[model samples]
Target: MAISSTLRSMGLIGRCFVHPIFDYLVIGGGLSLIVIPAVYLLADPPVMRDFTMLPWFILCSNSAHFAASTVRLYTKPGSRDALPFLTMVFPTVTLGVLTLCMFEADVIGRYVQLIYLSWSPYHYAAQAYGLAVMYCVRSGCELTQNQKRFLWWIAILPFFKVLLVATSKHVVAWHIPEQLVWSQVDWRGGVNLVTEVLGVLAMALPLVLFAQVWLTNRRSMPLISLLVIMTNGVWFVVFPLIDGFVWTTIFHGIQYLAIVMIFHVRDRVARPENKRGVVFHTICFYGMCLVLGYALFNCLPYGYQMLGFGAAESVLLVIAAINIHHFIVDGYIWKLGRGDANRRVVETVAIGTGA
Candidate 1:
């Protein structure tokens, strides 16, 4: 209690961890991205083994948060305005078929995994960018068109490097040793050369973007924004391939839960359209995520195995397929257009008209 009181008295920099910036950058995914590896690096051998697999497995199974958010977005009345039945229905069927194809044909499954793995980095980066912009505006930063573009591109650049390098033989994620590179394009230089060049650009461009942010003063970069973006770069360096996947997914889940829950609560309170009481709705939202998370993340894979898809292989494919589905569903849902549920969610994070 004394320790927490000392912490509370530390003011904005300290308190920001729990408040306006919490969902946007600090605790949700961003802090864990740092703390997990720090502890893992400091632990002894036996402790390290516990760090290796168990935490990651638990985290991976917690993907129910993503499902919970996605389910709410779709389940809400009139969400279909932002996303049509065709958009939602087609991907559901197609991804399911693709999952089945993985059992039947190796090539199809590999591509499915490839797309999901490749998209994961970009997805993380994009979420960081969104939260960064929200916090930037909330904290009184005013961004012009060019400045926003620079920030956007810089936020995306690191993850883009992941996607580009992933096109060649390199660390993918999970148990897989190599990511799929496109077979068709023959570079005048070797593929390694292309990846090397991209890497350099990725490193240099963000610095340039930051300089521009400083120079123009159109919008000051929020401290939270910097932390969020920096965490992305550091996270990859700390855990390049294997444990990286687990840590990132967990962080992503926490981040998603924080922001989505905020939106859910806000929507329930602010909108007359909502019929359920705030406390009931909030409890239901979290309860669904906790229960559904296990079912989707743990049970679904076992269900696949029970159907004789080969336990090990089917579990892998099930995860890959679910991730792909999450990506597709999420990609369409978060646009900040005119009146709709998604717009409301994004608006809740805005200070003014958004930086």
Candidate 2:
């Protein structure tokens, strides 16, 4: 009872994990952003070019997170019936694209890589938008359409900075002639200024919106939701400055794994015919992800290399395909609209001590 009172005082809303602690730390990603980076800085680990070199980390973090969405989508009962095109036809489409990438690793593969890279920041921002709004909706904060538009603008504001960075001379040389690069027109200073402003807006706008909600409603928005917003801002703007790609990706993966497992375990246990405990379901889901992740990231690349593709390009193309495919799969599986199974799972107040 005391714990429940504390949670209410903290503005707890719809939560993925059993307790607020796991939801705030793992799903919210606020605390992990601080703690994980501090540990990494102090430990000063060796730089790893390829994650597959660390088999355990790959199986647990990188590979497992990518595979989690795929596992969740296919394993869910009625998912095929609910999202037939995504569950059935999408795999074939993804496979066809992967094959094209392999055959034209020099041409199609490069574009595929760029597409994945460019789309990733947008994807991360979209997830942040989705999760933050989800908590509000679950907590009975009915947002006006205008309010949603404002929130989305704040969420995607960070992507503009990345877009500007991608167009700079160093990376832009890959596609366009050097003379026509974004920086050559003497727009570098302007671009830098704009990116800096966008970065500040990305971090500050969330706080402004949170305050607006409080003023309008006479109550605070869920603390977890506010944390989710700030955490994404930190992930993209702050962590990237520290470690570039590795920190953001690892933290994003951790967030994904936590939320995905919550949904997977909850759905399994809610079934009347299912008898397994939360721990059992959690292990089984992660174990499946590990096996599939290993196969997709490791074995598939090896097979491509054996067929005469360069090892590096083979890995890159496979990764591009998997990341793009997971992005699409997530778009389908986590819908919260009327009649969506995920709506039931996501909006419920799931308080327990199990998963």
The top-ranked prediction according to lDDT is 2
- Model 1 residue runs over 4 Å out of place are 1-21, 24-30, 44-61, 75-77, 86-88, 163-211, 273-280, 345-355
The residue-by-residue lDDT of candidate 1 on 223-269, one tens digit each, is 56666666665555345544556566667677676666666676676
lDDT of 2 by residue, 48-141 (tens): 4443566676568978999999999988767999889998899999988787778878877667877788778787888888888887766665
Query: Using Cα atoms with residue i matched to residue i, what is each candidate's TM-score against the true structure?
Result: 0.74, 0.88
Summing lDDT over every window of 10 consecutive residues in candidate 1, give the lowest-scoring window: 8-17
Q: Highest TM-score: which candidate?
A: 2
What's the number of clashes in each of the models? 2, 0
